[model samples]
Target: MAATVEAVIAALRVTLEEAQKSREASWKVEAVNRWIGQLPGSWSGRWRRLVLKSDASGNARRDELVAHVRAVIAFLETNRQQIAQSRKWWPLRRRWPANSPIANAPVAAPASSSARPVNLLRVRKPMPGIH
Candidate 1:
């Protein structure tokens, strides 16, 4: 009777462990499904390649990379219209502050300003009417 009871208890424990494991696996699959659904088509090929590579090593880093890429892609897609509109519009013009000395610096005068003008009105008398 004791042996039978122990066997039954062990069986129940095994079944419970199996159930928990299945639940965990189901959750993982669900998460994966959600990710795949939300991911953009452009990134699918790259992500699929990374997943295939990582599957052999069982490392989930590649999956994390895929998730990051998917998030960035989704963000860009959502904001694309806004970005386009912003590009079409000119950026706000910022007026220079009146108190900013750099903005009020004296501009250098052109070099021509320093040179004397030609004396066009000078009377050139030929030396003692020698002309």
Candidate 2:
């Protein structure tokens, strides 16, 4: 279960968006480090060595690091097609399911898979929470 191009891209995008939305340095660092751990093959090791954040006194410093990484992500977006078809990625691919269990979880079947439609909208309860 190696990491597909879609998984990598999605993970990177989600991490960036979440970190951008949060003002806390610790939150940003944790999000980024988690992403780095999920990176495919050597990428994980490489990013782990990089400086995401240190005992910084303020959020500004940590945010700047994440901002700089966004440029690299933008480049990745532009070259997505190329990266998807690259043979190099085959060996470097990571196990996507290992990092995202929710995505791979079994979808529960309907309790009444054979039954017809249940018109819940028409048979509404006498308004919930009413005495």
TM-score of each: 0.25, 0.43
Stretches of candidate 2 above 4 Å error?
A: 1-3, 26-30, 36-39, 44-60, 89-131
Q: Report the C-alpha lDDT of model 1 over 1-131, residue by residue, as the tens digit.
A: 23332333344344334444452322232223333333233136423331212234343343443454355345445654553344212224545676788778999986767677868779575798676
Candidate 1 CA-lDDT value: 0.41
| Residues 13-121, model 2: lDDT tens digits | 7877766776765544555545544544434443334325545642335466567458546755686676556554345566475659876788988686677787988
In Å, residue 27's CA in model 1 sits off its true spot by 24
C-alpha lDDT of residue 15 in model 2: 72
After superposition on all C-alphas, the RMSD of every candidate to the true structure, in Å, is 25.1, 13.7
Best candidate according to TM-score:
2
- Candidate 1, residue 127: the lDDT equals 94
Model 1 misplaced regions, further than 4 Å: 1-60, 88-106, 110-131
Clashing pairs in 1: none
